[model samples]
Target: MRYLVAALLLASLPVFAQTVAKPMNDPKTDTFLRQFAETRRFMSGRPTKPRITPDEKTVLFLRAQPTSATQTLFAFDVATGETKELLTPEILLRGAEETLTVEEQARRERMRVSAKGFTGYDLSDDGQRILVSLSGKLYVFERATGKVLELKTGPGVIDPHFSPDGKQVAYVRGHDVYRLELATNTEKRVTQGGTEAKTHGLAEFVAQEEMRRYSGFWWSPEAKHLAYTESDTTGVEKLTIVDVMRPERGGNTFPYPRPGKANAVVRLGIIPIAGGKTVWVDWDAKKYPYVATVTWKKGGPLTVLVQNRTQTEQQLLSVDAATGKTRLLLTEKDDAWLNLDQDFPRWLEDGSGFLWYTERNGGPEVELRKPDGSLAQSWVKPAAGFFGLARYVDADRTLYFYGDPNPTQSYLWRVRDGGAPEKLSTGTQGPAHEQFAHVAKSGGLSVATTQTATTMPRFVVLRSDGTRVGELPSVAVEPPFAPNAQFFQVGKEGFHASVLRPRNAKPGVKLPVVIKVYAGPTTTVVRHSMAENLLNQWMADKGFLVVKFDGRGTPLRTAAWERTVKYDFATATLDDQIAALKALAEKVPEVDLARVGIEGWSFGGYMAALAVLKRPDFFKAAVSGAPVVDWLDYDTHYTERYLGLPQEHPEAYEKSSLLTYAKDESKPMRPLLLIHGTADDNVYFFHTLKLSDALFRAGKPHDLLPLSGLTHMVPDPLVTQRQYEWVLGYFQKHL
Candidate 1:
């Protein structure tokens, strides 16, 4: 996938200790693919979604047991570094099987959360209570008493939040916003009108998929009113996907905005906690229709970031809670487009100023802005490798962020109220080390997650003085073997690529090459984490040299470099991969470049099919999974950002489409395999069908595999194993 990867392996056994695999041409005694699937690509049992308590005394996180995707809440004491489990699904369900509503399933799919049982939680302001949602029911786990109670909520609830004072909880049910008083157990509907065409308090499709705004509602301080979104999908396109395998089960139909099509009309409103008339927030809806993000905090006014339909311009607006009026704090405009950074506009507790990260200065920099929106201080100089704000402690007047000189790695950096930025997480062994520091709001308590080329991932506790506390524990199942790979900068442009040869290959033996290409703007494939290379190693051991490349259009670079493929995705990225492959052939001769096969999924899958079609001399075969054949068929936000609206830039869409090449009967076609899930909503299965239809009309032969009961992400372990085997087998027969 372009936005995601095929396999995510963060934890592994002590196989990195060995420089090479034992014995020549040796196959792992235990199939790495089997362990990978059974362990959920080693993502199970990994600690995630951590929250630091207000007192800086504890850090709470959610984790599952080994080989399990069902998670539970846990707390880590900062003082003694002692860990304790707070709640489990087994205890809460009481032998009853946890069930999810269709709404909950769709919400998890949008959030990319495949895990079950406490996928997320909300920590109460005072740190005395924790709120979790399970099987569509809201539950509060009292920290002091170690008790869990279900709230008096109606069915089909998602995206639950707590009132600032921790006295009440609010959630969305049946497309409308609702609140429940914790003390009295009273439930009140905040909004009255809701339907399938119009919804309240939940994010729209593009907001969650492209803009990264998950929640459609925000609560004002003191729990006086609720600010929420009302989306009207009256004229938006309604698409349906059939349950082809299980015809009796039916399908799903929802609003999906295609390129140049009408998007859901979204507007904001504020309603009292006791349920009264809503005061709609006013803005220029025609100019800035996209609400990128919203924030309503204690010391700051109701703030929101709104963007234009094309995403070329955005404005930070400060809302008046009483009057429901807004004032433009700042306006940002770019020639190409603006990439939304979710961490920006962080409000300070004193209400003196806020931090804003903008690329208008050529690179990303954290600038402290006054209440009037003028710059007060620039915290860090503009860096091309700027990741984003990690943790901010307004009480201590300090910030911890992730950035590094290398784009393939992220390191933790710290800055105080007046001092310059300091590089924390010292003792780095190599450039492949990545660090993320989760600091408490009160003080300098940080849980640093550090991953090196040698280690999987380790979470260590640290104090303000850089004193070692202890480690946050994990029960991730280790893999049978480590990836035998080498990462380096290939070609003059320093494009990041990794080549994993068979661990048991001899010095002079030549092997076929398989290029794993995900060359899309949404993902940066070449990272320091071992999680990215496990699948590459498995492919290498299948008697092929697995090579991966992150070419042009990948993020974490200058706008000039990334926008090279602005209107033409088919030319620039594919050219970069071909050039890099030529350079690699000269650097390492153990792999035969002439026998190259390309494979990818989603946008990567588009490139895989393009490589074999457009460059038949370079790539012998391809395996394209869920590829987007036409940019015009994709969503509005992601597609319009690069190629503009289909109405204006029709040539760009024509040039970037895979069907354009597939229709050319004059070109020599290469062996190709197309795989897609019939029920895929995002990059729907119709994409593959279109390509196959075009190929058939062009008298070209190709293979197709339609998976049933799967979406864009095939989360089933057994299916993943069988699918990979089929892919490997296909390459062996064709390449």
Candidate 2:
């Protein structure tokens, strides 16, 4: 299999994108674009979402065939080092075409799942049953017998999960929660009075989109009781997204709360899965409206994380399932918006203690607490690059995690309950590459994706003794060439950045440059991974030097550096990008300042547009994709966190908005190309229209390319191929 993967990488796939993008002058770039789209940026055919069985013997994961977007479930036995097919989407659907309900489609969109087949699966606590949902239908795979059975349920089954005992499966359908008894093949409704406006066992839009809490229900340790959220989205504003290219299909209306608007009134409740009275968990909903996270473990209380509207404060409340009462266990506050750690309240099985992560002392750190929530020990000093726990081995009471010693690289580490931290991942000496570990619940087996220098991601299974068991094979096609980026730092503060020069360019000749920027919080652009620089190299191959840098607002840095962008997205970000560019130009003479352009998508799109308008003298042209014209048009949780409530801080909204600079006659706009999807629900299509309207009114020289029947993600191969061609063409023409 390894030989086959290597052979396939050396071989070539016929170009399909050229049929659509044949008009481009550079055939090499056109072929690269075609391959990039077909391979999903060379991301297809990679194993993902590996679920290690409870016994720590088998590893279950999802992978697709080479150059395919569809994925299938497979299992690997640790002892035999052999992999076998568990389930395939083709076999489930047979010859019929699969259909996704609107709710499921929206859910996948929120999760950013672009693949076609089984995107996710849930394993029973005993590891006997595997529950998966495809195209609104539910199925369970029995491990012992190797038999797959379809659970007879209503249409649009969402978030189906097996109970702790594995005898039953519970899911939300038609705004209500239902449980299916496996033995009798019977289904029972657990809740009543569910409507479109009041959804039971379904997460609200903001919670799913911003808070990263996808499921609205969780089963108890014994599987007797279930906790769920009932959300009332009555007063929230509705945004109707329509595919303008096909208007006859009508529009999709969804509850979308803007900044300062009414949010979903979500209430927590505990109800018996066997059908009984409901007990509502008591909390101050008016004060902390965001139900961030909920955790229920064997020896711990049912703790829920709640955040205030402004996200400046949050609290961890423990709820008594029987009495429906709550107690505040911990509180975290920040002068600006608080950054959350998803992995917390990790309770130990012996009921001795649990782990809690916080940033109250400046950066992220973890603390161990006793059963009563008293601090037992501070695990480590605040590490800015500390990612959440990968796993907690209950038997040994050790925690496995991924953390970065510096900004550009990350490694997997393990720390026993009372011992110091130890690095589990290797390749610590060379240029930075990402390392991730997934230790089994039983603690003897672990699967890690560890890379060094310029290698593709390889999922290697390792033993507890630090010996390799085997590698999970990947048929993912390699890029046309390795993206060997020149990694360095810029500015006096040493901001992380990378520059990619044309491979065949003359040393003395200067190259036109494109500064690709996505300097947003929670993400750092410049990394040591070769895969991270593929697009930059692709652009550089087209006779342009591509530069990318993580400015002050990017993560994996000091909290003070990220907080600088708070309430002011206009000046500080642009000034930092300019400073980084000027500093880079001082070091590399090949950086041609006379021909500089900028391009980005989403938040970066907003920045790109802001560049040409605010600093036209620096950026000659820009290609802004799916930009937010005004901060007021964005969603509530994200916008309000950075730029306060629009009602209270109107000046921040006005200053951050592209329309503000577009309307300013003193700041002249340069050549710009605006690309946006007509069906974009995140940063809606209204943004481009609004910005284009303002620019038109101001007599600005710019171009607008509207993608019909598309969303925020350009998943369609033809569409993305055309976008690359247009982006390069616009920059080449203007510069």
Candidate 3:
């Protein structure tokens, strides 16, 4: 009996061993994983540029290849899952021949010898034509027959916009707005072009970046008038950008208004659509720092949102269309900075009133007001979550909007006809993002739905009542790259951290950890979504555990969490991050305390640089890109929000400045990599340039990579690739 029992135990022991010894690269598992990775890469490849179609029946999107070398336009039916390819590189090159003359073709051939091929284009309002600019000249393509029409046979014609009536196209040529009548086949200048001395109908550097505004003009709904802003830079200081690569050509000095410096004087004007004299609107000439938001009302007044120089106070003014008389409707003031909404304002059917978004009561909410400025109703009350822009307001008076009810995720909510709001969909644990397209006649909504963490983004059509009508076809599945990634709560403050582990990580393996952080008031890094950040993945693949946390001061969370770091922005946010990290290091044994690196860009970059300077014992290395080393160095609109005015709180600015905390000659800190573009007008290249000198004076060893001609966003691919390589090399050497 004893011998028989031993035999049974031995058999069970072998079965247990087989179950424990799992293969690392099982064929079925690897195939599924590869497919999952491919799916993610494919979705990432989908062009995220805003899609706007004429009839609103289809969405015109740009699709790019995996390598991002080839891109084409695709039309996706909003109602159906059907998709049709509209343009490709080969097709565009073939169509270019029909549009260009022999000499013009030869010129483009010469230019293409070194230039990257064209990729972006805009479709006409009727959806039957597309205006594509390749090599330089604008070419109009007939979508049905694939024929081409040469609109402007010239050297420079950029950013073309179709007229509302679809009979003409307007573009920027030589810094002036130019109109090209498609029917008459004639070109006319809308404004006198700007030279070295003057700039007309085009935005300057500060306005474009800090204000989050671009272009100089907007076409009226009737297509008979063009409303534009003219910026006079006669008084603004000029910052010269020297091009060392082509020293013989010399450099250009642009009107760059540094902090506390004089900015351009701006004013609004309306011009005849055909071409005529300009009519300056009724503006307060004393208000030199006026910013305007012009929107055309159906048959009534034109709403213009105006702000003062300091950007602390904003007023919504309705202007009489014919008389040009302005009347102030509503006013909003913020102790820090008033938020601006660039989206199209919602107007009622009768044109008697409209909806406005304000944070007057602490949280961003909606308010309905009459044309005379009196409050009609409270459309949305202040809540814990932030109220996003209203997507659609139905005739039944139910307002549909997108907002993060919880800091970690966003959901669609519908406020009944002047009633309380209700969550629409089944709330997911992770982040959920919904983008809507308005149904033309019925005012219904179509959405591109995506749930993060486990599910992929899919398109869905929803009824007015928020019921799903149908689901569009899902994209091919990609391999699981960051399956271990999960959002962990940091406490009741709604603070959370996104944690990702190495793919082949084993229990008890002490791996180096990297924290990609952005502790800012306007942007949040951690959210519920399937989108994989390339930088985070690269670090994880190299055996480093990557984590991203949205501490206090980050936006999209509760008002308290966002405003907690108000006066002491960097200090409070960094302390929260370090506290979270220490807690994580103690709880997760896989995290190695001896090896920790921090990285970020812009505001995040500011925090990253501060992390190593303030907490060198916790952070080993830091990589900062275009960081605002000093709060006073940044623009008024963004910096003032958290730190308040420099005069109001000088100590806060001094403490937050990275330069102020530079190590003494004997007391040094961790290795730091400081990167900036030579022509970064947004944060100013002087930020890193000044910091480099400060670090040198302090005898701290650091590496500096100054990219030439790169802007704040770093749009150049070569520069971006170098940035990635530098970040990886820094972590590899130190972390």
Q: In order, what lDDT does every prediction score? A: 0.82, 0.82, 0.64
Q: Compared with the true structure, what per-residue lDDT tens digits does model 1 show for residues 1-735?
A: 210111111111111110111223223563777778878888688787778888888989999888888999999998777899999988878888989987677777788888888899999999999999888888899998988888888888889999999999999999899999999878899988977788999899999989888888888887989999999999899998767546687777878999999999999999998888989989998999998989998778999899998898999999988788999899999888888887778888789988888877766678889987888988776663568677787867888888776777888778888457887764447765554667777656777777755557767777877777777788998766677667778899888887888888887688899998899986787777777677778878778888888888887777677778877899989999998888887777877877999999999999999998888888998999999999889999999999988888899999999999998888887888887877788898878778877877787877766666688998888888767876887788776
Which parts of model 2 are misplaced by more than 4 Å?
Answer: 1-24, 27-30, 426-429
TM-score for candidate 3, residues paired by index: 0.82
Give the candidate order by descending lDDT: 2, 1, 3
- In candidate 1, which residue ranges exceed 4 Å CA deviation? 1-30, 426-428, 433-436
Between prediction 2 and prediction 3, the one with superior TM-score is 2
Ordering by TM-score? 2, 1, 3
Higher-ranked by TM-score: 1 or 3: 1
Displacement of residue 720 (Cα, Å) in model 2 is: 1.3
Count of steric clashes across candidates, in order = 1, 0, 9
Q: lDDT, candidate 1, residue 531?
A: 71
TM-score for each model: 0.94, 0.95, 0.82
